[model samples]
Target: MKDFSTEITYKTSRSSGAGGQNVNKVETAVTAIWNVMESAMFTFDEKLRISEKLKNRINSEGLLQMTSSESRTQLANKKIVTEKMLELVEQALFIPKKRFKTKPSRGQVQKRLDNKKKLSDKKENRKFKF
Candidate 1:
């Protein structure tokens, strides 16, 4: 993959939570935006995978936007958003290993049947006889 950071764009606004006067005065919150479809880092298939995995995060215009306001400084929030976006893209590209189904052993299956039978007999014994 090429430099994903190169294609990223950022927007800033006043953060809502905490930071007291800093929050109200400065635009500390950072919003990272990247065009997933237009990104040259990944192929079409990989872009498709990313879009599918991050459907909720991607806007109608096809821009993947993420916001971070954890820190009081704009730089910290910007760094956080970049890292967050990279991590998400990395996760989306990963392909999980296929699981092979296994059947229960014969002994285990027989034991299960025996346990059922024992329970049935115990229940049968609880009934009053004529």
Candidate 2:
């Protein structure tokens, strides 16, 4: 994974889900925010790639934010949120292999036609003739 720690800023809030009274007193929910435009880790092209791929996650301010509140401890939540952000960025930067389009061979086309004809024959036989 890339070292994005320098570009991230975290905010903590009280978690909303389970955990009894501990939930009320502790700020275990963490939100990690990173500005794609301001990041030094990625080049201009990489920044553009991330912006395009992760456009939904990034706000109008160009900040990519991820939140995690599953853990009870603030530190644990922070780690989870950071990991989530890293995963998102990594996915955004990934380039899939291009697909090569190819036509089916004569044997394949003939096999498919044969299968269709067999099905049609079976269906035709199932019909009740007067």
Choose the strongest candidate by lDDT.
Answer: 1
In model 2, the runs with Cα more than 4 Å from the true position are 116-130
Q: How accurate is candidate 2 locally (lDDT)?
A: 0.92
- Per-prediction TM-score to the true structure, in the order listed: 0.87, 0.85
lDDT of 2 by residue, 40-130 (tens): 9999999999999999889999999889999888998998888888888998899999999999999999999999999999999999999
lDDT of 1 by residue, 1-130 (tens): 3459989999999999989877779999999999999988898999999999999999999999999999989999999999988998999889999999999999999999999999999999999999
lDDT of 2 at 28: 88
Best by TM-score: 1
